[model samples]
Target: MLRITDARTGDPVTATPARRGLTRVEARVERPDATGLRVLLTADVLVRALEIGGTPVWTVLTGTEDRAELRARARALGIRPFEDERDGGPGPGLGEAQVLRVCARTDEPAGGLCVEVAPADIENGVALDDGSATALRLALLARPRGTELRLDAADLADAEKQLKHWRGAVAGWATRPSGPIPDPVRDQLRAAWEDDLDVPAVLGVLRKVETSGTVPDGARFETYAYADRLLGLELTRDIGRGTPA
Candidate 1:
């Protein structure tokens, strides 16, 4: 339940995941210089987002406080944060600060792999879309304590195919009637689908509920998990199938 408020407006702004670690991540919004707004991070441990009651709840990351790691991550995105007192320390104060996370961004690459999207669920894995129509799934399984990605690259292709013919045959059973899932959630899911975002994974989860004879509850966090899984799975298959690079 971390909140990212607007530094200039003091409003509740959407705070995307910077990077999830277990060390001490002293996130601060350094003063915007001629370049732009400089965000700083001081952490050592990064973990996956925990979904509780359908909410992405990040854990309390406290470790050696690897400021370098966080700084490097920001740099990759073309965001430069002063490592030492080089460009002067962080701004007077952080305009925004909450439970820092390793939010996946589909717009760019992170680490070495280009994840499909950030982690929306703690149960699902991030994805790798190799510039193709397909994708691969990599579970972000942890030791039940953190949000670190727990799966290896080799295992991504082993996930069960979500779009198989047999799988679609059971859509009726898994499909939600209409009102079961809230409107806001439905809108969110709909928006994602329209953009070809994370449709299959979420719809797949709902279908699972139908197969189990349980109604699909469009829980906020669950929706996120479904979307993430679908996005990751798509890329997993894409990469696994060896689609042209």
Candidate 2:
């Protein structure tokens, strides 16, 4: 079972009814090796209240050391890191850093994505129904590509459909939920659903592309490369194929 805890207090903060505050959600998945499992966690702002004045909080992210550790961990599990494509074309920018941040904190299984939302990302005092919607959407646009794995075509298609459906459902629930949705997460999700260009469609096509056998097993890095190409194509189409600033 996945457990969430307050990173600072180490107390039970996740299960509590949604309250306006800074919190982290910790995900613990069973390890694949059976010898032991790997764990991963990320920090996100749980927008509990919209009307309160609070201190500015910052998320601490490490580089160099954690990156090396996570790379080794993924290798041990027979999973490869996404290839570094910044030298030429665009790739999952900052995604590696985010992944490393999450993996360094826990030992969990593979196949899940985690995101962090900081307090600075949240804009208080704005009505949720107003233009804050677009602000939130742009926030997701700014987020780096999450995972770059070679997925089975069928699996990719299924994940795409599931993501689309989840986006719609979550958007509707955001307006009024019998329960509560963290404000920060709610905004980011809604934005991704509304403005993210062709994420699902790109994944769907990638499924078919991978099955052509051009990318071999044990070559997961190539999967990232392919995903980047698909993303570039989609973005190009979105911006008339011109250079993306």
Candidate 3:
């Protein structure tokens, strides 16, 4: 089960509004038997943890941050001065220093994650070639407090595939419903769908029965009262629970 947060208030939200813009959303995913699993969708990072034996693997791709940022990143990964350096020995410049590059291990078989780099910064001691320097920030964001941090590389081709499938499914929903839908009641249900308050299976039923390129403005409001009421009740209950819907 999961609860999505309202981007502004941090309160739980059920659906993505078609009109009202969300500042952001973080998915609080919980499995009854699994603990410490979290999914965050933000302006910068959109990563999902895929695990086998409780080991999380994430694929990342972005082209931001500067050379200074990369150097800072190197330091964060435990890169240190050479042991042979004397008290005042000359410090190695960017060209010679090594930065710990990280890659999530899950996506390797799926054609790999294509992470971009600031190609111009390569000469500035920033190891933009591997692009793993940003992993620590993303990992820490998703890691639960008190958990030991462990990083690895993985494949992420599945991410694009999954997104494509979702888009395709949504596109199919653009067609109108077979029959008529009274305006007021459909307005209510559409609101519910926009709010993610209605049970998905029920919406599927409406879509099949209405067949008229969506809901009609007004036909039989009385006929849909029961369905409308049920969805409203469900929405109310979800709001009260403030956890899962």
Candidate 4:
């Protein structure tokens, strides 16, 4: 059962589908800019989590102008393509009413949910070009949704360093035979993501797993691969590239 904080009611609600088999979800962006990238990525995470929980999701992206550029950025960040993409309907950008209209026009059930992400407060003179897109994604996921993301160069650097370290570590761990994810760690991971997509908590769990002497290397490899299903960080990319020194 996926539980998310209801943006409308401020209460935790089960993401139940109106229809038996499909849950309709729409992610709205006011513009196809850096802030929109955050919103798109968040929605992608939500979709992945839902699918992991055995829910068939129909996802739509609204208010995108440059489809080509948006798709490129999303691909670079490991976001799956949306099933449907369209511009916003008649209204003042992507306000609540506009979101509802977009959903309605697409035959989304009344139970369908719209995820409206808040804009990130990026520092002046900070360019996303400074770091890898995957690292930028990790940096963004480190922060909670609805809060203004004060992204800076240091955050990007830390994210890049963490990604590099994890990939290299995973490469080394992959030399051993695969094992199951430890039960406690699996539960912790599920709890974090199930509780309103608490990705930072999930990352904390990974940090502990990385350093714990009790976990076998093979188990560590499995644990990271499982978590990467949700993280989309491509942590195993370094595997077969030679282990870290």
Better candidate number, 2 or 4, judged by TM-score: 4
Worst 10 residues of 3 by lDDT: 112-121
lDDT of 4 by residue, 1-245 (tens): 66776555557767653323565556665556668788788888887777788777666777667777887778888888875555544322331311221121222323334444556756677666524888989988988766666787888889899899999999999999988899999999999998878888899999999999898999999999999999899999988986573
Give the number of the best model, judged by lDDT: 4
- Local accuracy by lDDT, each model: 0.29, 0.28, 0.27, 0.73
By lDDT, is 1 or 2 better? 1
Tens digits of per-residue lDDT, candidate 1, 52-129, equal 112332222111145455444444322323334222122222332233322222222212111122222212443433
Whole-structure CA lDDT of model 4: 0.73
Ordering by lDDT: 4, 1, 2, 3
What tens-digit string does per-residue lDDT give for candidate 2 at 1-245? 11233233434222222233332223222232211112221122111111111312222222223445444443433332333212311112331211112332333222223322221222234332222222222222233323222223344344334334333332332233233323433343333222312244334444443353542332322332323332222111222222222
User: Of the pair 1 and 3, which is ahead by TM-score?
Assistant: 1
Q: Which of the two candidates, 1 or 4, achieves a greater TM-score against the reference?
A: 4
Candidate RMSDs in Å, in order, are 14.4, 19.6, 20.8, 5.9
For each candidate, give its TM-score against the true structure.
0.29, 0.22, 0.19, 0.84
Model 1 scores a TM of 0.29
Per-residue accuracy of model 3 over 91-127 as CA lDDT, tens digit each: 2223322111111212121111111111010122323
